[model samples]
Target: MSFYSDDASADELETLGWYHYDLSRHTAEALLLSNGTNGSYLLRNSNEGAGFFALSVRAKDSVKHFHVTRKGNGYVFGFNEFPTLQHFVNHFANQPLLGSDAGTLMVLKSPYPWRVEEPSIYESVRVHTAIQTGRTENDLMPSAPSLGTKEGYLVKQGAIVKNWKQRWFTLNRYELKYFKEKACEEPIRTLDLRACSAVQFDYSQDRVNCFCLVFPDRTFYLCAKTGVEADEWIKILRWKLPAVTLSVSSHR
Candidate 1:
């Protein structure tokens, strides 16, 4: 369940060489920025949600994540839509993609090739595809262990500034914690999951994949990199709610 469930389809995509089935947003950014030149690009499963793909390209000194939205059986990146990924690549190869502000032009010069011979490709693809498909490893096969904890990067809104900053978040059995960075020794804050009344998606926010953690004192807003990631986090947190509530009842 971690990758495309259809073996034939996945094998076909693998042959493209530019389709990286297992790359995460941050990992993609790191690889493209550190190893690739400007215009170096690759395609991967979008964190946004099911049936979505992302275009990660080295734009200027940094990498930009663009969701290639599905449109009426076709796919779109910018202004134009293509019938297939092959056509999309062919069209963009000659035409330069306009920068966000229309200031610079980015050409698809090189493709960050896929490593077919890598030993980890199978596992990575499986996990990633499962995420997109909204199924855990356990769901795919009973022998697979259930996920007890979830950790990833999410943008959190500050209480005072109301501005968003990406933080490393961790959710466990008893509490949820966020750190300023992934390697930080201490957490910025921790919320007892027992106090969390509910976790729900907040579509009111002017962003995609926004969710709210409802606590008695206040509500915390968080934005995940992709809709699928947000949904998974919400699922795990909600799953913990019943146990935490039972613990409270036992104490009473």
Candidate 2:
């Protein structure tokens, strides 16, 4: 069964305007959230397995704008306000240009070996994991025994896809393939959604949607939905997590 089967009811497909892909070590989860208002999509990868990366796209004056972020380390890349290509070049000198086609451009870092490409307006910005250290055994499997639902989360596993000494830990062999497969999914073809904010509040009906999760080192807000009722949904999510946390934690 699909991971979203049980929580399908909780998800309002119509409200999910654009497509967002969450790729971890084990599985890739996609969601259509809000419209393309906030951004085209938000992409995340798992740090435990390897790490996470995200892309946000927005439209400006008929041209699509892109923003890319790496979750844990917080590396951000996007177009600058410079008017000419030379301006972009002067700033990021060490990076090598990957490709430029159909009004889109691609670049890569020869050192970290990262790939940055823009495929389209609504579908702009793609980031591939780089081999920081050397190669290692890498594999992608279900995070847990069972699939996860929107209501239930899953833990995925990544190990050596194949056995080899030199190519074992090299992220280029397996990790890149995994990320591309997850990122290459067809982006939602609409333009009416936005990203849910990390923090939000609603004044109507005397209720507020404030949700926060405290990891050992950091805190995250999992609430905030897309569109007009986003604030309200944030409140609902805030109230829900405490109970949900206990339930999920106990099981873990």
Candidate 3:
């Protein structure tokens, strides 16, 4: 479990600055040179919540800096530029660590300038529109259930269809029920279908349905069981489908 994977030489670490270790707090404190810029900075490691600290050195400065701290059950980000030790303490005092936000302070010890090259919202929209309009018989299509009628049915059990390539799939009553049961057991955050390889759809204990939509980096699942559910799923998918297709196309 260490989240940070910075690899640098011991001499490089020393060049950054001397570190003060706090075993009780599980942290290593040190001053770091901001990249290669004239400015300097302080960095501390909470061991990524573990017990070990890794050090590294830099020859330049970073233009932007971000810090992650524990807050509630997740994490919150703090931003600053060449912050002083006093500023660090005051900021931490006002916003104490919460369980939601847990992690060490990642100090960017550089003033290196950078730029982002993300697609604009309008570009994204245009790309998606093109993808939707470009679909043909050979192209991937939504699962059969999503294209079928919107009627509820009684199911006894369910299973995933084999050789399924396209993302949208349907489930029977039992499958729908199973999906609901599984979804209810987990918190909304944990049940994020975006992170899941496939979503389980439960119509009833005996009927289940699931589908997998492949993405460049990951796969998305649809948890629709009934016709209505399928329709709603399709609507959302249709809205996002173009964007996914466009991204894939751009990469290719």
Best by lDDT: 1
Candidate RMSDs in order: 18.8, 28.9, 20.5
Clashes of each: 9, 26, 57
- Residue 102 deviation, candidate 1, in Å? 64
lDDT of each: 0.75, 0.28, 0.32
Measured by TM-score, the strongest candidate is 1
lDDT tens digits by residue: candidate 1, 116-149: 3444544432122123267675564431213347
C-alpha lDDT (0 to 100) for residue 196 of candidate 1: 80
> What's the best-to-worst order under lDDT?
1, 3, 2
Per-residue lDDT of candidate 3, residues 1-252 (tens digit):
123233332223223232332222221112233123333223334445632332232323422233435332223343432133234334443533222133333333332222224455553221111234566744634332233222222222222542322222222211221223332443222212222222224333232353344445544443434555544544443333433454565586
Q: Candidate 1 vs candidate 3: which has greater lDDT?
A: 1
On residues 213-252, what C-alpha lDDT tens digit does candidate 2 reach at each position? 3334433332223333344433333323333343555687
**Clash pairs, model 1 backbone:** 1-130, 2-126, 2-127, 2-129, 2-130, 3-126, 3-129, 47-226, 48-227
- Which whole-number lDDT from 0 to 100 does residue 98 have in model 2? 29
Which 10-residue window in model 1 sums to the lowest lDDT?
Answer: 123-132
Model 1 Cα shift for residue 130 (angstroms)? 18
